[model samples]
Target: MAEQSLVFSFFLIFTGAAILATLALYTRQPLLVAYIVLGALLGPYGLSLVTDTALLADISHIGIIFLLFLLGLDMQPSHLLHMLKKATLVAIASSLIFMATGYGASLLFGFSQIEALIIGAALMFSSTIIGIKLLPTTVLHHRHTGELVVGLLLLQDVIAILVLLLLYSGNNEEQSGALAFLKTLAALPLMTAGAFLFVRYVLLRLLQSFDRFHEYIFLLALGWCLGMAELAQAIGLSAEMGAFVAGVTLATSPISQYIATSLKPLRDFFLILFFFSIGASFNLALVDAILVPSLVMTALVLALKPVVFRFLLIRISESKKLAWEIGFRLGQISEFSLLIAYLATSAALIGQEASHVIQATTILTFLFSSYLVIFNFPSPIAISDRLRKD
Candidate 1:
């Protein structure tokens, strides 16, 4: 009876996911949103269809691993380096600016100082996954707005990775703070240099030899990603960072696209599980305590994130219209923000309320982003005109 119950729960959650996914497709909404909604409906907070939340949480880690791996496959070390120079500067400036703004807002809204700080920092990250997905599949990705958005998103992802590493490694111990910070700072350079060297000298040669064997190439890529991810974790770097670097290492290869496509199904599968776990494991008590604050946070993200993007792009010589359009395209909280919230919770650096706050904000923002992007093209000047009025 016990085993049957567990099996039944798994089937229920998976079935809900599948059914909601189809609904999402039909409605032109993001599948991510559907998964969250489904999870919430089936989780203990609702229908109580998914009783083994811990089991789902454990399996969800695989999604994170594969998510990072796919991200790695898409990044080219050389291109990433070039993109990083601009991305780093922009990411730092934008993150600091927004963190201050968000923190101030949180304080104004009566949150505790520590909670405010966590909220601000988590809000700094933009979602690479959501942003990229919202982009049209046409040739526009090569355009100015697409390119700028892509670069900025990449920059935020790198920053998010570093933040996760330090926060988690610190173990919430005041004594470990300095060491963890220093270690994280050191790991970035080492990882970058190491990935470049490995890809240029080792991977390039290996890839050349096995280019003809597609299956071998795919398996090799997979092995390299997972192997590096474990090594990175052992060395105190993030598996997410390691996987991203792995992808960047292969970005210059002719087979990069093939690898990305090959890994897509895996990435999608795991990522959906990740999002579902997020919904399933939601802390229900937060609904009453954080609801108002989460709404405020969501509005800030939706309204201000794009404004910052527009200002930066315009400063960099992009046309105002292009900048506004791109900014509107990014007007949402990212998955990384939720990930950071989770890390902070794990480190005891922040409360579960903070995690719930971020999760809700991200879910709300994703819903808004799906609508904005899907409608933007049909009403091209709609967003830009509104910006003008404001």
Candidate 2:
């Protein structure tokens, strides 16, 4: 009976998603928004068709790991390094400004100092999913704007990982904070080096030998990604970071493109679940309390992010048009913000009200940012025929 219920829930989710996706296309809205709405309507807070959201959310996290893996597969190591170098200053400067903005806003709204600090930390990242999903892979993958956007996002992801580590450490005794941080710092380089060595000595050789067997290649790629992901987690680093390294190590392989193309459908399947999980987890009753602050924070993020990013990019010698485009493409809070809120609240470092505020604000920015990108830019799901690419 339990197994049967789980299967039925998945059936409802996919069926509802298809119908909503059709409606979204007809109504000129992003499909991601449709998925989220479907979850909200059917999930625990609504009809309760799917009550075990924690299980679904855990499964859905693989989507993000796979997404980053595919992205790394598309990038040449040299090109990635160059882009990262150019983007470092922009990322650092923009993060500081955004953090300050969030911190000030939370304080003005009467949040405690610790809550304000956590909220400020959450503001430092932009949504990787939105930025990459809306981008037309065929067109933007080779463009200067794409490189800059990808570069900045990567840099921000690194900072976010460190912030998460800090938050985790804060839950421990005060004396353990520095030790925990140092361990994370050490783990990253060690993981990178180990991935490189294994790829060079073993993984590449296996791939070379089995390149003609598509089935075998697929299995091997999946194993490599997940293996590295588990290894990273074992070493106090992020699974996503490990998956990315797994992809980058294989990027120069002749079969990397095949792996990327073949895995896209698999990646999207999990990603839909991920977006749905986001909507499912929200508790609507708390919204009344957090509404005003959520709206204010959402507005601030949407308005200020683009300005700060554009200025930083232009100051670092990027073209004005390209800078502004990258800025707007990133003008939304990240899914990481939601994770930080969850972790902090669970650790008793923040209040439920603050967590709700973060979740609500993140959702609002995601919706508006997707709409902005779809209407104004070249994307896979652009509303305008001229803007639609891929």
Candidate 3:
């Protein structure tokens, strides 16, 4: 197919997404799964209608940045820290188990040790998008369960940032990954200090002065989000993390809710592109090669994550019901998992075969896990009227 104009691309993508989404709703499937399937159907591996996937992937990442930002806007710094402390051991313990599971599965499939390690590292996270989006505010929000779910996810995000940092420094032959990790860790306090100072001095004043200008408020929020994202990247942290800090800094502002509410539509728009890019980038031809290993790993993730999480949470004195709920809610491979595959490939630490295995497994788990959650839980988009809480 010929390259399409930018306008035409948007037209085609959104239109296709809407049609597929309607079908998904009618069929009682998740809208996110529809987005992924649409991408697979229209992307280069399928029909090649949307061959320009690189740009779409880049745009889709902003959705994650904004998602974290909105998440920060809702969270209190002190509360986050307290929960992070409680969640630290759980995240670490669960990640090690998941990582080992992926490693064994990859090695069994004849991957090199390094490839298996990278794959294992990739498997250590769950999809924040799926976890957050499917949660019903009316039922889960403001509850201890909601706090636990959000805290665990945020803790996982921090771990992902460190993983990405290590991958990034792997690109620099002169720098050791451990040293880079320390530098990034040290810089975080400075960045946090700077963000708080800037927000207190400049951001608060602007919000107070222009409290009535809807347009100005919108522009300010967007600029602050992206600016913080850039700053985070500058300091070796992920843009998503930076955006989250930006939101956290403004969490105390009366206008923070307004900014969050306004930006959600924008966040949803970009997230669609993100999920689409996941599907578009997948190479269906590799399915035959990676099929067995991918399925095994997907099954491992689906089965192991819930059990481990539930056990750990229960051991920590959490109720079995809430423990099980959060466990199922987080039982999928994450977008960060895809990023690790891409980075490891870029760093020449893994081969195309290993990367494809990770991608395929992540997508498969995303589809199946989403269905499991919606079918079993109270979700905003659950098909069952009794389970739908939005």
Native-to-model Cα distance after best TM-score fit, residue 80 in candidate 2, in Å: 0.7
lDDT of 2 at 9: 78
Flag regions of model 1 displaced more than 4 Å.
1-10, 64-68, 71-76, 136-147, 169-175, 346-349, 377-390
Error of 1 at 315 (Å): 0.7
Better model by TM-score: candidate 1 vs candidate 2: 2
Write the number of the candidate with greater TM-score, choosing between 1 and 3. Answer: 3
Candidate 3 similarity to native, TM-score: 0.96
Candidates in order: C-alpha RMSD to true structure: 4.8, 1.3, 1.8
Please, what are the lDDT tens digits per residue for candidate 2 over residues 1-390? 889987997898899999999999898889999988988888899889899999889989999999988888877888888998999999999999999999999999999999999999999999888888887776744366777778888888889988888888876887788876778789877888888898899988998887889999999999999998999888777788888888888889888999999999999999999999989899988988999999999899989998998898889887787777888899999999998998899889999999999999988899999988888878888999998996
Least accurate 10 contiguous residues by lDDT in model 2: 136-145
**Candidate 3 residue-wise lDDT, 1-390, digit = tens:** 234466677787899999999999888889989999999999999998888899899989999999889888987788878887898899999999999988888888899999998899888999988888888754545356666888888778788988887788887765577777887888777888899999999999999999999999999999999999999898788888899899999998989989999999999999999999999999999888888998999999999999999999998888898889889999998999999999999989999989998999999999999999899998888889988885
Error of 1 at 101 (Å): 2.5
TM agreement with the true structure for every prediction: 0.84, 0.97, 0.96
Model 1: how far is 6 from its true place, Å? 7.3
Model 3: pairs clashing at backbone N, Cα or C within 3 Å: none
C-alpha lDDT values of all predictions = 0.72, 0.88, 0.89
Cα lDDT over the full model 2:
0.88
